[model samples]
Target: MLVREIMTTRVVSVEPSSTVKDAALLMNRHNIGAVPVVDGGSVRGMLTDRDIVLRCVAENRDASTLKVSDICSHGAVTVSPSQNVSEAINLMATEQVRRLPVVDNGRIVGMLSFADIAREKAGMEIAEAISDISMP
Candidate 1:
């Protein structure tokens, strides 16, 4: 399986210059924890709910006036849509990240996550006696 098999395609992104408050609001409305920060048609960073709380709210910075570029994680790790699911999973595990933005042809096309793959794999009822039901 590949990330393109289960990644969310209707990804929502924000400009790096967008205010922190705007980003948070979009996340809240969509019930997402992060947003890709784009600049001039390229992904520059990733802004998560934690960034808002830690960089702005917790630091006494006004979210209304703070730019996402100032608080977002710059040079975020990214994944290619054509890569195998294992590679994407390894990247996330190594980085201790929950989500990975998918890039295709120099464009942000989708986002993949650990839970997405786990749930997909779990849903397959391939064989009744494939293996013991116990873990070693």
Candidate 2:
């Protein structure tokens, strides 16, 4: 199956200039852990709940004053919507990422997550991916 076959098409994203609090609020409202940071019609970075906690809260930075660009992880690993599920799995495992932004024409079109893979009944792949991601 292709990434577009299982990816979440309705992606919720944030701007690079958006506040950390705004990103966190979006995550809360969407019940998601991460938000793609976009700028000028392109994905610039990825902001995660862990990024807020560890980079802002843990560092005593005010989230309201901080920009998503200040805490977001840049150069995020991405996949094409046309890629196969196995390719996505391999990229996830190799990159130690739980999610990948699905890009098309330099624009983010969707998100592919480990949960999406698991829903495809690829339990062993999920397990292996998780193990690789969690490795020390």
Candidate 3:
């Protein structure tokens, strides 16, 4: 199975200049934890709920004034839509990321989460990936 076979095609992303509050609201509305920060059809970074809480709220930065680029994790690790499911799982485990942006032609086309892997009937793979991600 390929990443495009299981990845969520309806990806919700934010612009680099978008406000942190806007990213948060988009996450809330989509019921997602992270949003890829994009610029000119290219992924620049990744902004997660934890980033907002730890980097903004805990640091006393105003979400309304802060840009997604300010709190987003730089150098996003991504996968190609044509990659195999095992390859995606390995990348996620090695990168300690629960979700990965699926790129095609330098543009984000979808998102693959651990849940997607689980749904693919790779129970053992998911468990191993989770363990790797949780390692200290």
Candidate 4:
């Protein structure tokens, strides 16, 4: 299987200039944990719930005044939609990331999460990848 086959095509993305509070609200509304930060159709980074908590709340920063780009993980590791699922899984483990943006021709195409892989009946692989990603 390929990444595009399992990736969530209806991705909800945010702009870098978007406030952290706005991003958090968006995530909450979508019932998602993260959102890809995009600029001109190119991925800039990823703003995750963890980022908001650790980087913003923990630091006592104002979420409403803070920009997603300020707290988001920059240079996010991305995967090609055409890439094999196994390869994408390996990359996730190596990068210690639970999600990856699926890009096609330099444009944001979709998102691939552990849930997406797990839904594909990759129980063992998903377990191992989660373990790897959870490692500090």
* TM-score of each candidate structure, all chains considered together: 0.87, 0.88, 0.89, 0.88
Best-matching candidate per lDDT: 4
Q: In model 4, where do residues sit more than 4 Å from their true spots?
A: 123-136
* Cα lDDT tens digits for candidate 2, 82-134: 99999999999999888899999999999998878886756777757764663
lDDT of 4: 0.90
Model 1, 12-126: lDDT tens digits are 8899889999999999888778889987657888999889999999999998999999999998788988999999988999999878889987788898865576567765453
lDDT of each: 0.83, 0.88, 0.89, 0.90
- Residue pairs in steric clash, candidate 4? none
What tens digits encode model 4's per-residue C-alpha lDDT throughout 77-114?
99999999999989999998889999999999999987
Clash count list over all predictions: 0, 0, 0, 0
The 10 consecutive residues of candidate 3 with the worst lDDT sum are 127-136
The deviation in Å at residue 117 for candidate 3 is: 0.6
